[model samples]
Target: MARNPAPFAPFEWMIAWRYLRARRAEGGVSVMTWISLIGITLAVFALIATLSVRSGFRSEFVSTILGANAHVTVYDVGRVGQQGQLDRAIADYEGWAQRVAEVPGVTRVAPLIKGQVLISLRDSSSGAEVYGIARDDLKSLPGIAQSDQAAGDLTRLDEGIAIGSGIARAIGAGVGDTVKLTSPNGVKTAFGTSPRVNAYEVVYVFSAGRYDIDRTRVYMPFAEAQAFFNREGVADELEVMVEEPEAVNALTIDILRAAGDRAQVWTWRDSAGGFLRALEVEDNVMFIILSILVLIAAMNIVSGLIMLVKNKGRDIGILRTIGLSEGSIMRVFFICGAFTGLIGTAMGVVLGCLFAIYIDPLFSFVNYVMGGGVWDPSIRGIYRLPAELNLSDVLSAVGLSLGLSFFVTLFPARRAARMNPVEALRYE
Candidate 1:
């Protein structure tokens, strides 16, 4: 009778499984198994969690930037004044804005007036960014219009200024409460230039969910702003919203031609490109660092396997004498490491995925344990700590962990396979 030889035979699995069991009295590699298993599991979990949070943070950052800001801003680069400000305004902004609106990808085109002001209430005072925009145009903004959140009544813009929630809180002014706005760019009297101080009712309170924007932004009626800033019949810039913001570059030519070449354009990317690049760089650096962690955990297998081979030396010699081939012996140890890697990776994936999928609950639990202050919107510029479990990121982590485990395990696995039966038996 002819019998066929198979790779990784049933006996090899049986032997490998047997060795994996911890026999504490016999002093096997039980501790090492636990160490390697825990190490790989924790390493993979950390990598996945970090990558997911990074992804979520990046997503929230980009969305906030795009939501609360102009996708493309058109500035009048015509003439610089003595004070280093754009003295010349967009004179024909309406005509050009309408032309730009007709562009295929162009969405909203609002002519705006922007200036820095100081806002003060009864006892509180803070710096503010005053924006002059029409009521219809302000309502048309996606961040405001599409929000399910209550950002006060847009109807209030007719009679009073719309202030951000942070500004309202800082100045201790609520809806219908009066707030004084003092601007450096004020009316010129006999005295060189007196600061313009004006009072307006805070009609609306809106939150952009951003610390910087909410803390400093105030919106006024376009007509009122013209009278206040003393720039009647002219606009500071044309704020444009686009359908596909990421491809904002594609519409540059049409916008330039429509707004005229004299008009300078600034995209969202132009203003925040450095920040986004920094985030990307940080993501890469963190991945590299965590990958090294995974490798170190994978390397823990080598020590355990070496000790395992030493403990099983006499058994190895006896098995070899009983006709087990070298390949069979190697496969047994390989199975040991491979099984550890597989089980650890599987458990890690489960935990990591659960963490990402339930980040809100997880953050809530952590925040509760830490007694709050887990997420600081003022510093982080976002309301929540986010996590996004990406398929690709998980796969990359898995590949790295398993590949390192298999590669590192080869060292001691090969050592066990090459043991001479006579030497092993003599030593025993």
Candidate 2:
């Protein structure tokens, strides 16, 4: 009786494994196999790493925008006229805010006054966008109350102002310094137009970690702004926060209904829609382009296996003579190709994840060596090149690579399987 085959040994797999390990002198196509393996590895690495970094950038940008602004804003449409109408509309803001806060998904509401002004220090002056927020409501804004870089308490702002780091640097102002604010909306006197000018001590300097915000925004107490702008009883708009920012569109309708026809609502997406849409389009294009790269790498598996089949022709004839079924022969080459793909894909996953995890430090090291601020926070509103390794992305990449590897194997494997023993040996 024939000895029992080892518990798990299958003839096809055994032969495939032996062939894969065979040296060049022993009929193994080592060079082509390695070339195929490396190609797949590099392709997968590029795919995962590029996507991860792009994901990181989108996440960081969205958070930065939300930090500096509310998810939804309600504008007083009725207040867009002469002083009497404006005063009447503003007098009803509290009731409108209360009604909006009752709307489903509405989380927080804060009234704000916004206008253009010129900020001046002893040495410098620049045009700025000034925001007047209630001191109690200041904490509702993402980066307002928690900036470690701020020199004073944002919550305690009274007659004082909190300016961005960029503004501070541009105007040469610091904590305890005084800056003059001149509103563009001025009053007309007998002589001419008089711009409303006032001085406020700089109690806090905040870095929102965003270039545009840090460069141009100034925050002061709401009541102070009302007085300074000569709109004593009114705010320009209401900043609304929702439970989920992505659901702002649906909730915007609710807010509008609750606030009445005199109010108009806009979501953060509305404010930054163009920029966000461009990012989404770019991400999709990148995926399509990188998938082509992966497909090209898969083609290498086809060439390598085709070469392998030609080199192993004599062995194929011998194995066929020994009663190896055609299906078994096909499976042998299929397994060989698949094994190469699996190894390369596994390696690529490891390499990609490691690269993403250490991306920040790697960039820092390169920047230090190059003696340049290649990843400028001031330019992108981010301190580093962010990377987020999504598990689905990794899994999708693996599935795609393996599917391509398995698919490319079919033709060469079928050719090897259909070899007539006589014809195969005739050449040998």
Candidate 3:
């Protein structure tokens, strides 16, 4: 009696499934299969996790930097020198600020006096950037609205000043304490030029979520800042915030036209371009390096499938003799390799997403065990490790892995399909 031909199923699929599940003793599967699967899983995990962290870091950096600074700044073309220039500039500043505020997309316009001053509390002294801004403008500043992190009321800033957490710590000054500020631009005296010195009461302490700002920024009332710097009624620059900071470039012409020829415009991107560009370059390089890792893993699939074909020579011969076509034979091995890759890719995607989501806690746990700052945020200029899982990145990684797996299987699958049944059986 004639037995069922290849179990009465699509011989290609049936053979592929059987080969995948075959025991070591039956010569169906080998250690190489598991190695390839594990390799693919690891490669996918690393790629996804790294890319997510990179994206997170970029977002955190941008937000933190912009939180402390305006999206755009308008500066006077000439320096504010004597009383005449200072008075005229101050008179024109209000009009300029009002006109700029009326421009489309302009959310807020703040006239500010910024200058470097030496801050001293007893023996300890540190150089700090002093910003004189209106109390109302504080409400519009990003990261300044977090009342939990601010020690005192910004509205109460009159003769008092607010210092950053870093500045407070550096000079051992805090709320209710007094610190001295010395300006380099001093007044001329009969005895010669004397540096302008003044004492300020620290009434508030703010954490701007940025290392540089938190470490070196001090804020005072606009009028007080102008008076302290000996440039009463004059502002050095006008800081402008927009509805959408990323689109500020599009609004440059409108802003410039509003400010007229006396003021020069500087966008946030222009100020931080070098740093942002470096980060983008680094992200691209990392992707390329991680992709190479996946390629290496894919090469393992090639070797494993080749060995699978060699070890199953007798089985291939029997299937050929039983009327399985060369096309079916090739598909059997192709499915075998593709199936392994697909399973690995699925597992990797799941694992990578989970890893990215819990990366912060995982690092904390590791740091506890290791007794060190393994993932210190201060080292990277942010407050924590951020991870933002991107779907496109995940899909790209998966597609690359599977594509490499499929491509490598072609040569080995064709070799298995083209084997002479007589020769394969005679050898077996």
Highest lDDT: which candidate? 1
32-88 per-residue lDDT for model 2 (tens digits):
889889999998999999989998898888887877788998886663355454432
Q: In angstroms, give how far residue 149 of model 3 lies from its true place.
A: 3.4
TM-score, cand. 1? 0.92
Best by TM-score: 2
Query: What TM-score quantifies how close candidate 3 is to the native fold?
Result: 0.92
Q: What is the C-alpha local distance difference test score of candidate 2?
A: 0.85
RMSD in order of candidates: 2.4, 2.8, 3.4
Candidates in order have lDDT scores of 0.87, 0.85, 0.85
Error of 3 at 372 (Å): 2.4
Model 3 residue 184 CA deviation in Å: 2.8
Would you list the clashing residue pairs of candidate 1?
none
Better-scoring candidate (TM-score), 1 or 3: 1
Every model's TM-score: 0.92, 0.93, 0.92
State model 3's lDDT.
0.85
